[model samples]
Target: MSVEVNNETDYEVDLHDVQKLADSITEAMFIHPETEVSIVFIDEDAMSELHVEWMDLEGPTDVMSFPMDELRPGSETAPSESGILGDIVICPTIAEAQAKAGGHAVHDEILLLTTHGMLHLMGFDHEEPEEKAEMFTLQRRLLEGYTGRPAPKETVE
Candidate 1:
């Protein structure tokens, strides 16, 4: 799996860890022998600008995902053997603040973002309550499964 992560932030969000987490997520899918996702980490300012430009929002967001396929939400869209899945952009500064506010570690928050973005890439959405539940369930499973082996204590702690 090629997790081509482009870090555009000053805050040190471990690119290696992010890549491993992404690879584990792909592994959990099991269907795709190879998968690729581009992860970009940016600062609050850049995120805010992107939010406004792309999403027409005024403030920074923790993360934003741009799925390559146009598959309707709630439908599965597997990557071709080429392995290009989609793209995920993250903001670590906002993530840390959100993590503190949400009472979770920064890593946990980032993992959640990655999972959420991946679900979107796989054609999932939270436009409705049921859909949201389904997506969240999948996200939790991926996160737990990935962190379970790599950093057991930290995963829980």
Candidate 2:
């Protein structure tokens, strides 16, 4: 899988570490090796604009996903269909505040947001109670092994 990370903001993010974690998550989720995914980091103004334009929300959000091909996770024996997975837009400023409030490192918060955005790219949503349960469960499971945090809380974008 090709995990492309672009930091468009002024904040100092570990792009290399973010890419590594994104690649690992995509691999663990069984995304096709040929599929391409982009992770973009933006500032509050940009995020606010996108939030209003795309989601019609009022404020800047943590993360937003724009799925290109609607790809799903594949099995070990069968790779997922090859296509552009999607673009995950993250706001570092918002994430930093969320991390501070959640008592976790900002990087871990970004990882959680990234994973959550990826799951959205894979057609996951928390609009309903059941959907929220399933998506959050999977998200926590995916992060716990890496962040050593047993329970990861949910945040909206």
Candidate 3:
């Protein structure tokens, strides 16, 4: 998979680590090897603008996903087709705050947000109780598999 990570914020982020996480996620999901996805880190202002424009919300959120080809996870026997998966936008400032609140490293929070955004790109939703449980469970599993450590508790609502 082609995972492109772009940092547009002033904060320093481990771009390589984010790319690796994205790769691991796609691999675990059985996405095509040639599939492409972009992960962008933007400032709070940019995130707020996106929040209003896309989601019609008032303030900046932690992450936002804009799916392209609307890909879905595939079975091992049949991986997803090669195409543009989607773009994941993240705000490091918000992530830092959330990290402090959760008592974890900011990088961990960013990774969690990225995982959540990628799942959204792959047609995952958490609006319902069952959907939230399934998505969060898969996200925790994926994160733990990649980091080789237990993922932080899910606090997203």
| TM-score top scorer | 3
Candidates in order have lDDT scores of 0.73, 0.87, 0.94
- In model 1, which runs have C-alpha deviations exceeding 4 angstroms? 70-83, 149-157
CA RMSD (A), model 1: 4.9
Error of 3 at 151 (Å): 0.8
lDDT by residue (13-117, candidate 1, tens digit) is 778878888887766664254556799998888889988999899998988888774323221365334446788888888878877877778887887787777
lDDT of 3: 0.94
Arrange candidates, best TM-score first. Answer: 3, 2, 1
Better of 1 and 3 by TM-score: 3
Candidate 3 residue lDDT tens string, 117-136: 99999999999999999999
Model 2 TM-score, 2 decimals: 0.94
Candidate 1 collision pairs: none
Superposing every Cα of model 3 onto the true structure, what RMSD results? 0.7
Q: State each model's C-alpha RMSD to the native.
A: 4.9, 1.4, 0.7
Clashing pairs in 2: 1-33
